[model samples]
Target chain A: MVNERSGRAALAELVTSRSVLVCVGSGGVGKTSMAAALALEAARRGRRTIVVTIDPARRLADALGLERLGGEPLPITELIAASSGLRSGSSPTGSLHALMLDAKATFDDLVTRHATDRAQAERILANRFYHSISTTLSGTQEYMAAEKLGELHTSGRFDLIVVDTPPTRQALDFLDAPGQLARFLDHPAYRLMTGSGSAVSRVAGAAGKRLLRAAARLVGSVALDDAVEFFRAFEGLEAGFLTRALAVRDLLVSAQTGFVVVTSARPEPIAEAGYFLDRLAAQDIPVDAIVANRMTPRFTRLTAAELRRIAAAQDAGGDQVLRTGLAELIELTAAAEAEERALAPLHTGRAIPFQQGPFQQGPFQQVPFQQVPFQQVPLLDHDVHDLGGLEQLRQSAFDD
Target chain B: MDPSAFFTGTAVHLVAGKGGVGRTTLTAALGIAAARVGLEVLLVEIEGRGGLAAGFGHRALGYEETVLAERIRGRSLRAEDCLVEYLGGHGLGLLTRPMVDSGLVEVITRGTPGIKDILLLGKIRQLEQARCADVILVDTPASGHALSFLRSPQGLLDAIDNGPVNDQAVAALHLLQDAARCQVLLVTTPEETPVSETIETAYRLEDEIGLHLGPVLVNGVLARTPHRDTDTGHSNPDDPDPDDPDAEGRWVRELGIDRDLAHAVQQAAVFGRRRRDAQRRQVLRLTEQLPLPRLEVAHRPDGIDDLGALAEELLGGLRAW
Candidate 1:
């Protein structure tokens, strides 16, 4: 829970009420875990849900107790069965589903499904250049995330979809994926290359052919022929590609979409989160929640002056028992104070929420980000590799 | 026993790790360490927001190589510039800049799948072969991107059989896969997730990319619970509150502080010790599971404030190993 005004109700609404929840943040703040936990929590709430991860090097499959993840979603029935010591049918509202995005396979599926003719599809699919480059393509992962979301949404298979975006270096790249894909399809150079479809374009490209003939004399004939053939193969599908890319872009900013930003309280990560928030605002994407993971734990309650006076009394009176105990307290107090100092910068744009009492500590004070509701998850005692660990994280997320 | 021997002949020294694990700091420190050994070092940052320059106490560096120290220089590599240089190599010098200006460069770099990484690696490979420095320290992208960046050469080679891009990929591969010329050092924290990823990345670099692996540099390790190596530690570390009846009575009566306060302090110390103990267990797991040599740098409570001091500390650690 972030605070009294907003708490787990916000998370509950994001998971159950919304059609799609996209987790966005800088890299390495446990975004995968948060996404999985949200999906599982939604499933427990009796909503059919699936969480998709676009991180190429992810352990989401391992975290969900599956050996591996592929393009299709695998229902997590056996793991839930193992957890409650019951059979696979014990799951409520079916079960949660998970899959890692296979960029190459998804693109292939798109081509096969959308091509005008089987032969046209086969030519595009079997092109040597397409076969080699699709898997390790740079921007295809982000492009496919949007495409897959649109696919799953139209299929009506899952009521709620939780998606995890890749940790992109440039903050705008992920949001700009659909536009970039559409732009690529509509590029002048690309259209010039693939304009072999219409008779008008074919006759118009005669000048281009003459220019290419001159260049072919300068370069190798075989290489230019292969290049021309690769582009011509996709001529039949160019219009479909542009229209689908534009629709995917529109689906990203649709009313059903919501974004959740996850980050840590560290200085660098906070700045990164600010950058992400700024970009989202520019793009007009609604941010639902902010999750701050692995915040430093606090254990001290008394003020510094009070602790010093107690220490002075222990030293003067020479009681070893009280002295040793107070000494331990002092050391721990210092560590807690240092942690507070580390998080001080993030406390900007908000008043210090601390209030000192005689002996008892008050409720936990929170520093919300830009007045937006946010939840904080403490670092778990162990790494989460199985359903049991994920349950632990879920409990912490709701409790903390 | 020779610390410099690990880096003696390696021309391309790459520093990589999970994001937010201080890869940039370690790369700068390693570059300075190599430079101190009378080796000319160039610290290269590709697509980064000048983390290298910030570390060296300078304003953000640009495309041009800027000297930051006595024996070290820094360069921020961008795809557009690297592509221009690459095209100019093929007798297209006149059309390169205009192509970049008309926004055709981004479409080629971002739209054409593996061209961006291939171009970046091609640039790095050129510097390596040119012997621009005795040791070229590259601060690479975070783990997943770094792996793909290294894989671009082969990806392009497979996609285009024998074009100019294929030639560039072949050149990048020769520099990356030559174990005697290139070595990779991975940095990680003593946490579970980062360590797990570090282990996986190291395997991929060796098995897939075939780059030689160096010692795993563990950062942010803490000191023993109460007793630190420095003087600003607890007054008494081993013994908690000493048990003297007279002292206890005087403090309880005179200070007016409740027994709850003492208990709170005791709880805090226990938590501190427990964290340190957990970290030790994590470190042990890395050592037992990984075959690579490991070097640990303790957590600086204050911080590594200056790059010069950090370089000195890193040099000491390297020599002691």
Candidate 2:
């Protein structure tokens, strides 16, 4: 039998993620559910917690027993009481709140926060490119998510935040956006784009204008002028944007922040998880936990020899269809066994150190990385849609 | 709608689905299938997932296009290279090369999210216009991001009332919304979350984004597993009573495995049907609500491993549609 209690304890140890707990995984791997569930578990432990997600659908909201989600955190007191079948006075001591990201609103909020003046802020907000990007682009959500994180951290709203980054490539975009924006704020190119605010900007701005003129001849004068106007509106807000970006980046890799890399034991997700983990390790960001979600469960604990004995015994049975079923069962058990073997290392949270570069020129030697605490969320039968469902999910991941 | 109609005069195909729904596999399968039908095919992937190359049994592709199989070419769209291509399209290579060399392009595109998306989409438009292939197939980001990517040009247009950036967005909108030229295929697994997301994606792409809907391919569907699951919405002939005539009795006579093995088989059926039934309901819901055609691919116990298997599977899926 799978040791349910031990798995839960291992998972509980990682729950001490006091600052930020980021759950990263590929799409449709229960990453969002895990985020909210982790928050719920934290609250049950008497710790004030908030779950933040960019999930557009109502999955998180439904689990929190809310009709809809918005940018602000919605406390789940009523939902928790209802799930526990308790009256108001018997509510849990710790607070639980949830927030769904509003990308455009967050972007607009950032603009308002960073603008030099109301008029300049309005001008930038009205800029078609700014409007388009804030509302329609891929990175806007990630950028806003990161931006919101900084806000939550500074506000001192909760002791724990369970957040999930955007999926796949955007996960990197979320991580890299702060640095990119910070670098661009100080870059000569950005200075040129925004035009001269200082003596240095003047020299760079002149070169930038000539290049814009050159660029205008190719793309058309109208487009270049539009780009210039878009840049010009940001004349004095670079510092504000830069400070916040760097601050968020610092918070992400801080000691209090813990990352849990979620993936299935399947080959594809495991391989991708390995690459992502390596990227994290390369940056010196420690991952405290790993959740191998939705594994093909071991249906029976019978050993191979016992199975063989049963097979031979069943051959002389009465029902012909039962005989056929036996053969199919044998075939499936073998596959599951093989799958478990392939994913053995991941179950134990054993880190197999790998080199990033192919060549042998580096001073680094092959070394075993640290083992993270591990937990496996069983492949569940019912779809998660309610607060009670989340409790079931939590119990599956954590013994408590 | 006929499945082959998807190929007729369709210059751009955007394949989107939830993560791990086999978007890359379907894109490669389409590339191979199209090439086999005597059309040059170009498959492009963004975000450098290395899925496209791996799908075709080739090493991970770089920024440049490489031959994958007969009449098929694959390329991974990297932001840096796309920046070079974007400037080259403006015919300002000599002057702009220095900007790229100075890492100015990197800072600008990296900080600015839509610029990179534009560069990638612009490259696809170029391939479409240049007749580089009979059709260009793109394995786009997951549903939400794909929707944003499709709408990115609108952001540019809105940002620039008059400019080349505005013009680019206008042109992109022209191609993206022109139903005769573009067919967006939404792939999804038969799971609660993925199915709901797929339906949402379909609605947004059709109504909000204004793209032509291609056949929604419900992939990774479970094949027949031995057992009768009475609880499913779609009950099959294999319900577990021995008296059920259609049940395979002969195979039972040939059985020589233990009860644990039998239990595993029984559990696999229960597992398979839960998903199969889920997929069936979602697909039915999709077909019932939308005017789009639907196709089903039988789930291989082991998923689409490489190019050859996917190509074969794609044919079966297409035929089923």
Candidate 3:
């Protein structure tokens, strides 16, 4: 049997290995909390740490007890900084910082940083197609998240970085982004369509010399006209976007970065996690660990009457009622057992379950991590808007 | 439950809705329901949400179908992947690889204004032509794209007079036009935006694709009943009613509780029922305007997180239909 170490111990060992720690799972799964805890643990152990989150919820700020987070890394003043000042004899071993990504803002920054001139950046940003492509595009958000992660890591600011990835599909897109972006950048049709002259004016000139003329015609003259204008606006920065994408892909392949798949113990999530693992394996992305969040441990024995009562409750009328009162308990045990069985064969790491509780009024109370190791904090009955609430959250987080 | 009864055997199933309206959930549930009766099922997701993967709890899916549940399989089709593979098959493989390798594929796939929709429709066409599955559940992008996606084959067939592309487009149009072979379901929440978008999407898909529009799955509905007034004369929203009470006491006791909370709860229940009622009324209007059968899926509080739950909720009421 695997030893049940403290959350701090498990976190310290994971970060010390110099690998990428990718936190992924479904929405509302407390991925950000676990990521913050691990980063805090790492900082306490003397490693310079950064925990970045792409989830728009900003739960990280609540988890870290900060009023807000900037786009760039800021010192985690509430924990390490405060703890260090309390007692010189008990100085923190390391430093911690946090950053919350704004995807569109980051993409805009990339365009501005790489553009040949202010005029080009303005033009590209102004273009309707570019605007739509940058914001509404399916995987662009994930790609930009990965880009930011790589940028922070390569800057040499932190020894260990924890990325709280977006929801499942988007999280996978973080890995697939580089490849997908490369294809769009290199498509010859794009180059030809976006080339200097007006698509209509150059149609005949381009026809004899280029194969893309017919395809351009297929896209229609009006749309082709619009696409060429957008591309021309993006000309100066195309190469930079390409280069950054390549760098991010290389960093992902590096040994220093490891991905940790975080999920709940539910059958669906576990299966999704397994599928994610399979795809990662297929693509050769290094998976450092799988942390199954919100797992319920099974007791040695329960009376047959209790089991029957549980089964009877499963047949309850409403989906929410059944799920909360009965299905949840039964499914939790089954999921925990299933995850343990699945993780048994893996050579590198094991599974960790962070218990969860039913919803409560306060933001911290809403968080599942507070229930782990079992000393429950009374529900705050108010929203967590400032530093004090976060401190209470931290206390609850480490309650056991 | 005859598997074929769930689907209009001759119709192409186009599942569309606003984002987060649980379109993917409805599609997966429908697929499961159809599969349970032993129909060969092909479930498709176009937005690259891989929500189908989440719905079935798989890791990831590619262009090729992966078995999700018994008798059900699914695939995620992105415009870029389809273009690369299609181009490769047509001897332009080398030309597409560098772009694919550079991560431009996703951009090109999703970046082109209407290309993603076109490619998704094309992929569905291919699925329809193949005899591998008896029913194909297409979990399309949100209504914004879904309308354009359904209309794309027709648009392409009109644009390209005759060619291999046109040939495929025409075949797709044929499959889509065949009412017996294709159907469309609009998934929505009882909320204003989603319901409005659903109606608009339904009209556009029906007009353009000539497919049968099926049901609208209204998710996250609330239910409330009058509180039982105890003889001791106390009522708590948190506490369940002890037993049936007199009408006057029930009203008075319920009124004494938190007004806003009780009102909010009542509003949600009323809103949901009203939305369903409105949808049925609109369906009647639609039948008058453009004749077709319409169905409604009741709101389930827990929402659909998996195929089993989805199947039970969606098909549970189909026996009456």
Candidate 4:
């Protein structure tokens, strides 16, 4: 059996003590809200925390009671107390900051940082391909998120950095993005395109040349030439990007980092969570917790005899409307029971939940828990738009 | 235009929604709805997920179309496969293996932004032009990328002056911008956040992308129970019935109901009413904020069991719209 109390304690310890907390999940799972709430909780517990989110809905700002969040870090410590239903000027000992990822802007910043000079950066940024793919590319946002996370962590800006990953079609994209970019940088296609005047001929053998001709013909020589120019401009920046990608990958797997897989209790999201957990396990990454959000509350405590008695009473004296209401309640209760049954696999050790980290002595070190702490946040009566709602959600998530 | 034509007459229906809003299930139901009207339907899965096929109790779909139901067929389209097909059709098949191996296809399809989306849309356009099906339902990406995915054609037109890819974008744009030929069916749940996102996406798709908006499908709506006093003067369910201050007590005494049972039932009723009221407020907000018509599917906590009933409900809504 899972140790319920220790599981919760380990989760809380990981949240407050870990330097990096990555919240990964599919879309519409309240993953963003959970990230924000956990950050708020960490700050309330007296740790300087920053939540970097890629939420498209802008709900993070609403949850933090901010009018808007931007590319830079926005100090939200002062508003945390009020947002959490406390009086003004009663901010906690710690601080909270929020950063909303602007993929294009972050990408441009990376280009400028890694490029050899301002002119090189400008050339790369000005390329037609770069202009479009910097933001619109499928994996650009995910890669940029990793880059930003590495930047913030390396800058030593905060005690805790909570990352809200992008809502990718496959949740694993967030984890795979850095490697994908690194591989692309090392790919023969990139090498072939970026090879200088003489090197191009050497790199492009007869087959390669013929392939280029065919591609050039299909997309037109002009478009192919433009792409080649873009890659050529980007030639010298590969080393810097590859170095940072490797560094980010290391930081993600470091002991200071912890991953919290957030998911709703729905069948699809739960299954997605299972897939994420398995993938992380395969990678030997430690998943500190699984926050199952928006769980249906079960009322199965009412025994069948009790329900039967209630039904009998309703049938004896109730009108048609009362009968309909009773039937609806019974169905709802049954469904809630079924939902609870569906969640059994998550906690039954059917899925691998924990991985042993390297033996290290620290506050944030893995505590060797028997199971990944599975926390269920009940579906709220209303959407959490502000701090008070987050406070309510936090209590549901962490409270026994 | 006749409301029923939204399903029968439209050549392409691109169904999009934030993830977890039941977009796939609704697409399947819409396909069923259209098929019931004597229209052949093709369901296209863009993300290569088995969700659309799973809706029809079929196995995972591939590049080739498989019959899902009597009048419905389903398939998935990937950028790589579409590229290969385009090359093969143009007698440039020899370039496929080398280009794919050298990662040139990746650089071209993915490296050039919007190229993948344009390729997929171009293939969809071919299916439409060929009259492969009377109605084509594309299960597009989630809301986060749906905008950029739909906007790719227009974006490419401005970026690429002229080329085969540019020509493809022009053709896709032609199909996307034509109202009678294509319209986007946005799905959202009856929740505050989903509704808000739906409104924003709806307007953006219409204004920025210049795409036609079909009726918004509000999935997971709580069905109103019969014999409720909702129609009575009480707008808020929390407001107590002035006639019964202690209804639970009365039930316990008159019907021999246990006090605990009576209280439990009362609690359930209150929770259900509040949730239903909240759902109604969101739907009303959607109706007011978005000028598009709405089709609502009631919540089935167990899941969509009866596609026929759902199709009928959708048809009924379309008829009213």
Off by more than 4 A, model 2: A1-7, A55-67, A82-91, A113-117, A136-139, A172-178, A197-206, A217-236, A302-335, A341-370, B1-6, B36-39, B101-115, B161-164, B225-273, B303-306
RMSD of 1: 7.3
Best by DockQ: 4
Report the C-alpha lDDT of model 2 over A1-400, residue by residue, as the tens digit.
Answer: 2243455675565565467888887766777878887887777766678889876555576555566898888888754554353233433566788899898898888888778779988998877556655775556677788889889988997888888765574575666767766655566665666655588657566566666565555445554455457678876777777678778888888877878878775556665566566667767787677787776566677754566577686536456455444544454455466556645645443542221122112311221223465677876655665687687787778753
**Which candidate has the highest TM-score of all?**
4
lDDT (10s digit) by residue, model 4, range B51-118: 67766777678899999999999999988788889888877887778888888777876767788888
Q: Which candidate should be chosen as best, given lDDT against the real structure?
A: 4
- Which residue pairs come into collision in candidate 4? none
Q: What is the DockQ of each candidate?
A: 0.29, 0.32, 0.07, 0.40
Better of 1 and 4 by TM-score: 4
lDDT against the true structure, per candidate, is 0.69, 0.68, 0.57, 0.76
- Per-residue lDDT for A161 in model 3? 85
In candidate 4, which residue ranges exceed 4 Å CA deviation? A1-7, A65-67, A83-91, A196-203, A303-309, A319-328, A349-370, B1-4, B227-245, B253-255
Q: Count the backbone clashes (under 3 Å) in each candidate.
A: 15, 16, 33, 0
Question: Can you write out model 1's per-residue Cα lDDT over B30-101, one digit (the tens) per residue?
Answer: 888777778788999988766677767676677889999988999989877887787778766665554554
Model 4, C-alpha of B238: deviation from truth (Å): 11
Q: Candidate 4 docking: what grade?
A: acceptable
What's the TM-score of candidate 1 when only chain A is evaluated? 0.78
What's model 4's TM-score?
Answer: 0.91
**Which run of 10 residues does model 3 chain B get worst, by summed lDDT?**
B224-233
* TM-score of candidate 2 versus the correct structure, residues matched by position: 0.85
* Interface RMSD over true interface Cα atoms for each candidate: 8.0, 4.7, 12.0, 5.3
